[model samples]
Every structure is written in C-alpha cells, then in structure tokens.
Target chain A: MSGLAPVPDAEHESVPIGSNDDVVRARQLVRALAQQCKLSLVDQTKLVTAASELARNTLVYGGGGVMRVGLVHRDGRVGVTAVFEDSGPGIPDVDQALTDGWTSGGGLGLGLSGARRLVDDFTLQTEVGGGTQVAITKWAR
Target chain B: MLKIGDVLLVSIQVELEDQVVLELQDDLAARIVDSGASGVVIDITAVEIVDSFVGRMLATTAAISRMLDAQTVVVGMRPAVAITLVELGLSLGGVRTALTLEKGLEILARRDDSRPAQL
Candidate 1:
C-alpha cells in the first residue's frame, strides 16, 4: 500500500453531522466524492458504507460532531479519506471501542466494528479527555 | 445524544436523499441482523429514481447482512425503479428482492423453513 498526500483539495468539505438527519448529507458527499475518484461500483459502495457508519457514530454516540472529507491517492488507485472528529465525552477504552458488538449505547453491534471492516484502511485516535478522531480510506483497487 | 435504533428506523423515511442511504446502510443492516426478524426490508417507496450510489449501498448492505447470517431484501420497488435498476445493470447479485416489504419477509420465511432440507 502507498501513502496519500495529506489531502486532495485546498479546503476539505467539512460538515456538522450532529443529528440523525445529517448522516444522509455526509453520504451524498461520499457518493459524489467517490465518483470523482473514479471508483468502481463495488469500491464506491464500500467507501460509502464506511462513511455512513462513521457518520452515524458521530451523531448517535458522540452526540453531534464534524466530518472532514477529502480526496487522496495511494497504491496506484485514487482514494477518498474522511476524518471524523468529535469533542464529546471521549472513549474510555480504545481497544474495547474497536471490538464488534461492543456498544455503550446498546447499539446494533455494528458501530465501529462494521465501519472498521468496510474500509480499505482504518485508523482511530482517541483518549479519555481528548475526544476522538477516526480516519477511513477506500481506494479504486 | 441520539439513539441508534431511532436513527435506523428514521432512515426508512430519509430514503428520499441518496446520500442518507449511503451513510446509514451499515447501521440499518446491523439493526436488522440483531433484530432476528429474518431479514431487512428497505422501503424505497419514497424514491422516484434509483441512483448508482443507492443501488450500490443496497447491494453492499445485502452482502454484509449475509455474512452476519441474515438476509437483506429490498422492498417497495416500483416498476420504474426496477426498470432503471435493470437498465443500469444494478443487480444486487446475491441479494433477494420482492414487490413489497411483506413479500420480502415471506420470501425469508420460506427460505428459513426449507433451509437444511433444500440444501
């Protein structure tokens, strides 16, 4: 796997997907962004699914948050990277947060687990006092 | 803070927006699998047309649900939607479909009852 330029556009498309309503907005951007990257139907679906999961996390668990979406390239295929950051009560345990069927909100057992599974590349940075940031990527390959 | 269940159910209404469909597919799929209700019925009654992204999400969700040992059936597919999905060659591949949510559920029940014997 190759690395991407920090970002694609000069200014990333950032939005507050705080409400359950905002998840759709986030996904529309994902479809558009994925299309622009020339992603195939299967790859596009993967990316968009990952985006939807992350956006849902922002709204349901984080209690409202922001997602920064941008384009990038790596491994000879175009890619889109969306970074979700929230200032809400941060995760107390990162390892547990990454596990499947582990939801503080009594969720559907997908949450972070499904999102992490969908993306080609997934990374998370979080702490007790320091909020959380999740970056996920999907490529044409 | 919002609830995942509320959000998942509300996604049924937000079907009007293509983007919303993409963003909530997993959450919705997760809820359906966990519910043990046989399968999921994606009510596309509100959508006038089927876009590539939406079609792709449906296919993806179905595939994911299959891995979770559940089925994903698309419901309320209008004639126009079906024609367009076909013309676009948007086959959900392994996913199943029916004219309405009720029909989809019936399909699931049949599949479940005949499982080991059919195989």
Candidate 2:
C-alpha cells in the first residue's frame, strides 16, 4: 500500500498494490507526476486514466502489481513515465488484448488500447509465464 | 470530497483520477436523474485539479443531465481545475459553472424563470 518513496527528482517511484484503494492512490501519484510536468489537462487526464486502467487490470486479474512512476527527460523535453508490472499470469496474446471490445473478462476492453491512445508514447511488454508490464509516457507536446 | 447539495451533491470522492471517473460520473448522472430534483449542482472544489478524464466526466454529467431533463450546474471548481481545462482546451460541454452552490442555484432559478413553463 506504499509507493516508491517519491523524491523531487527520484526519476522513479515504486508502489505496491494489495487493495483496490491502493491502485487508485498509486495512479493518483502518477497523475501528480504528470501534472508536475505541466502536461495539458487532456494529457494529464489521459495519463491518469491509462495508469488507472493498467493498475486496475493488475489488481483485478493479477491479484496486485507494482506501479512505477518516473520523470523522463529526452532531448531537452521533460515527460512523465508510468510502468505497471504484474507478476500474475500473463496474457497469451498481447495483440488480442490490445484490441478494443476483445475482453474475455467482460470489461469495456478499452483498458489497453484506450490507455495507449491517451499518451504520447505507449509500450507494452509481456511474457506468457512471467508477468505483464505496461509502460506509458506523456510529454508536453 | 466534491458535493452538489448539502448531502454530498457528488460522492465520487475517488481521488479525481482518470480511471473509474466515467463510471463514477455515470453513477452520479443516474442518481441525479433518479432524485427527481429540478436541479443538481455539483461541487468539484475538493478536486483541486481536473485532468482530461475529470473534464470529460464533468461534460458527460452535463450531457446526461440534459438527457435526464434536469438542470445541472458545476460549482466551486478549483482554480487548478479551471486552469487544466483551459490548458487542455476542454469544455464542460453545456454544464454551467458557478463560484458557489447558491450562485449556481441562482443561475438555475433564473434559467427556470425564462423557461416556457413546460419543464
């Protein structure tokens, strides 16, 4: 229920999720980081929702996960990066999971792809026997 | 900590993040519709910041309020929320904004007065 101890310039924050409320709080911190980057409200909201969905997926399907929030600087530009990692059973088909309305779990199925659409950068890495990780970054653009 | 009336005009105090915001807003729209009150004023004061998701939720609530045929006004929106919305180039759609619930009510009442006396 705690996040990676956030420092003004930690570059990364890790949060452990054991409950539903924990997911929400962790994601909120990520959003705060996004806001600190001075992203537009649209971008800020997009990042928060994406992080929230990923965190929720980790909790709902994976029994909990660790959310990594960080600040990224690239080419004189600053951005917020969020990485959600879950060690639970991984997705068999990452492509299928990204498709909208393709949920076998009866959700809106907008969790992955929808999240991807909200930010400037989206990357997903998963392993069948390992776990699931979704990384997203939103810049000032 | 957002409220509409004396009894929590809005109870989706779920951190004002983007996820679950639409769901929370949907629930709020349904509750306001069901309350049968002529007007519903939402106070997002506690939500010191409004990101895109929160903005969309507010706009969605406004559209739903119109659909439910109820008067809706957003009151006590924080400066941060307003700033974010402006930066995002977002809108609350047709939702009205007020500095306080009483002011929102005053606006709603004024709108009601000019109505065709139908609703």
Candidate 3:
C-alpha cells in the first residue's frame, strides 16, 4: 500500500459482481488494465486470474458486490490494482479465511489464499455483519 | 462440443461463467454415460485465464468422467495460464493434461488399448 500513488476516477472502472457474468466481466476488465499497464503476459494472466477468483468470492460468499480496477503507479513502476467490496455479512475469522483449504462456501476454498499468492500486494478489511473489502495490486516487472 | 470416435471433444472458445462450468460438468458426465465414451478431451486454447474456480471445475469434471470410466485430458493451455495456475497453488491434481488435442487423443487411445480385454 505504501509508495503507491492514488489513481484518478477517470482511470478506474467498476463492475458489479452480482452474478457469474459479472465475474467474467471483472476478469476481462482487469486483463485490459493489466495489458495497458505494460505488465508481462504472465503477470497479466496472474492478475486477471486473481481478480476472477476474488470477483467470484464477492458474488458467492459476499452475496453480490462490486469490483473497482485501476492503474497504479509507484516510483516509475506501473501496476494494476483491483478492489472488491461487499455489503454482505463480513468474515468473522480472517486468519482462518486466509488459510488454505478453509472455506465457508461450497468452493474448494482456494479463492482467498490463492488470490493473495498471485498478486504483489494484498489487503483485507472486514467487520462481521457489516461489510468487507479486499484489495490486490500486481506491479509490472 | 463433438464426439469423435469413442472420445468426446469440448473446445472452450469463450470466457467461462461459474454456472456454465457447473452445467458443463453435469452435461459431460451425462454424455459420457450416454455415449459410452472412454475418453474426454477439453480444449482450452482460446482461454486466457484459469482461476481457482475453473481449475476446480476441470478437476471435478475429470473426477466425474473417471467415475463413469472415462479418461479426461485437458489440452492447449497457454504458458501464462500454466504459470498462473502454479503460482495460485492449484496443481489441478487428478486431471491429466496434454499440449495439444491430438496428443490428448493419443494418450486416451493408448490407455484404452492398455485396458484388459472386457469380460
């Protein structure tokens, strides 16, 4: 989170994650931004895949939400950042949620932990019965 | 999707939705039983991303096909997708993969030959 400059609203796009189609749109949007940021093909794929995982989590676990994606710049380095937010019941135990093979939903339980691995920076904020927000950034190298 | 000889070939040409993937799994399972196909080839040459969900779908589909006595081979994965899958910690165990559909068919054919004569 440190050293990353704030992105203007014009540079960011937000897509709703209400259904399966929204998840696919979020992935496509992230891929477009990653490519525009000049990230390597591998990096772009990783970021896009991570975004897809998070978007699905927002829809399935979070009970529908929105994903905001934008280009980030830090000290001559460029990156793509995606944030997923939801108003559904937040996670009660983040540590357990981040652990591999732990899932509250029917998924294989790899979405949260696996998305963290694919990105350079990952952060999560949640409050039980309130809401949740997860942000991830992948810098070009 | 098409049936070639004793194998079912499925080429994914568009971005996959979660529900769609689930439906595909059920459909493939039913098709395997109905067609009595011994092999299933899923081509992902046009797919650009393989997330945890899609990865799980592939594994689950393979497992379902296996239960029906069919070998499943996923082919044509892009290099970037492979790297991402590894980094994401999804090895997609239990799902066999090949570089091309042709190679996948060959593997299945070999497996079919190696199976002991049906009693």
Model 3, A1-141: lDDT tens per residue? 222333324668888899888988898889888888899999899899989989988998889998888987788888888989898899999999999999998887888999999999998988898778899999999
Q: Which residue pairs does candidate 2 place in steric collision?
A: A4-A14, B4-B9
lDDT of 3 at B98: 100
Q: Compare the candidates by lDDT and give the number of the best one.
A: 3
Better of 1 and 2 by lDDT: 2
Per-residue lDDT tens digits of candidate 1, residues A68-137?
8988766566788898878777789888887755778845445576667666788877767666778888
The CA lDDT at A70 in model 2 is 83
| 1 or 3, greater by TM-score | 3
Tell me the spans in candidate 2 whose CA falls farther than 4 Å from its real position: A1-10, B1-8, B11-119
lDDT of 3 at A63: 95
Indicate the residue-level lDDT of A99 in model 2: 83
Q: What are the per-model numbers of colliding residue pairs? A: 3, 2, 0
* TM-score of every candidate relative to the true structure: 0.59, 0.61, 0.95
RMSD for all candidates, in order, please: 11.1, 6.6, 2.4
Candidate 1 vs candidate 3, lDDT winner:
3
lDDT of 2 by residue, B1-119 (tens): 23344223653344654446766777766676556555667776666455444665677777777787777788887655565455334555577889986788788777767768664
